[model samples]
Target: MDDDSDVSGLRATLRANPAGHWLSTPAPQVAEQLAQTDADFVVVDTEHAPTDLESVEAAVRAVDAANATGEDGAADTAAVVRVAWNDHVRIKRVLDTGAAGVMAPQVNTVDEAEAFVAAARYPPEGHRGVAGTRASRYGRDLDDYYERANDRVATIAQVETAEAVDNAGEISAVDGLDALLVGPADLSAALGVFGEYEHEQFVAAVEAVLDASTVPVGTLATSLDEVDYWAALGFDYQIVGVDAGYLRTGAAAALERYEQVGEE
Candidate 1:
């Protein structure tokens, strides 16, 4: 929140900001280390990890530290959480942990997307219950929190299935939905042409989402070539793999070179 990088307004930044994500291992050090990278944001993935409430809290704190300490306490980066699903309990928990946004996964239809917003948003506008959480600063400023949260916390719908692709337009029509986030891997799997998103059909699906989204679309691209590709295609937000990739790549290359030298 201190960053002026309104999680809710990330779509606006995508016009100029090149946001990215790194998968952290539910460890504060991991998140902190990843935060030190050049990415605009760090997405805390709780979907595949055994991240409990406490770990999520610590990860946020670490990211905040990484973001805050960098430039005279100016907010350099943001901490977001990808809740396991679009469930209320998980959504509330992540928000309580001070996540600037929630990435709801496996969205297959418009109704599911609507439900996600409803569960994440606070009353009248949404069914989300008011709570004394860290995100709201423990009810210390409930009114201020409510007034800002409705506009501050972002909602990202992960388009992961074939059905989601078919209903992209309807899903994108939902108000308060920040970005139409696509999970290309799951999409490939569901298409029955696993890992073949480069195929014509998959590419068409991507185009359909792009054509339909009222807001800017977000995705995870694999390489610099891919980043250039997406940028040309008008994708506003993207994650260019992880910090681990760079580290592991260099480490493996170094190990191989060392082995060759020793053998020589």
Candidate 2:
């Protein structure tokens, strides 16, 4: 990555298109394929996926390769890794993989949000230990990377609990936080209305976060309909699809079609 080529573009893209959509996948090949599309970013999910640091690094490289091979010679797609937790070790390791950003899950307070951002930043801003990692081109671009990493790295906090909803404003106000994402499945489950997005309590919690957030707010949308639904409800951005879900749906449809043809 070049000096000016950090996640700044990703941040700018989201700012320009509040309803910008992203895709999440655990596979590097899948991430590369998705990154080649118009999606603003592709998330390599470590939170719920069986992905490790090595996989995250490979996925980030794949996304970068996709951008390098774009038809126009400039692909806007960036790689954002969803770290398994708010721990600094995980956040630092993922960022070192050259991911454009890191999304920390279950951040429910200002302190947690700050910690999340700090882990992605270098000294003076945070305590992220510097190294000649892939992010710095193995010591070749260390100086430039260190100088720009703090500003270039985008930090996102996932609001999944009632406490997060109540503290959304404070969390959003954290200096280095780029965005807030509502983990709908977890948030709903926390509110005793699992999968019931239409439930009053669930709606209220989402609305609370939406209303309190000072930065761009987003959520995960599993289907096309939910895209419009969340957009209408004022979500700033969304992860529109999941790789596993797509595979299952596509395979099922293909089998159903084949069964119908055999019956005919």
How many backbone clashes does every candidate have? 0, 1
TM-score of each: 0.87, 0.90
TM-score quality measure for candidate 1: 0.87
Local distance difference test, per candidate?
0.76, 0.81
Model 1 lDDT on a 0 to 1 scale = 0.76
lDDT measured at residue 4 in model 1 versus the true structure, 0 to 100: 32
Q: What does the lDDT come to for candidate 2?
A: 0.81
Model 1: weakest 10-residue lDDT segment is: 1-10
lDDT (Cα, 0-100) at 122 in candidate 1: 87
Q: Per-residue CA lDDT of candidate 1, range 11-114, in tens?
A: 34444545777564778988887777756778888887778889999988887778744343224667778888889888988888877778899987878888
Please report how far candidate 2 places residue 210 from its true position, in Å: 1.0
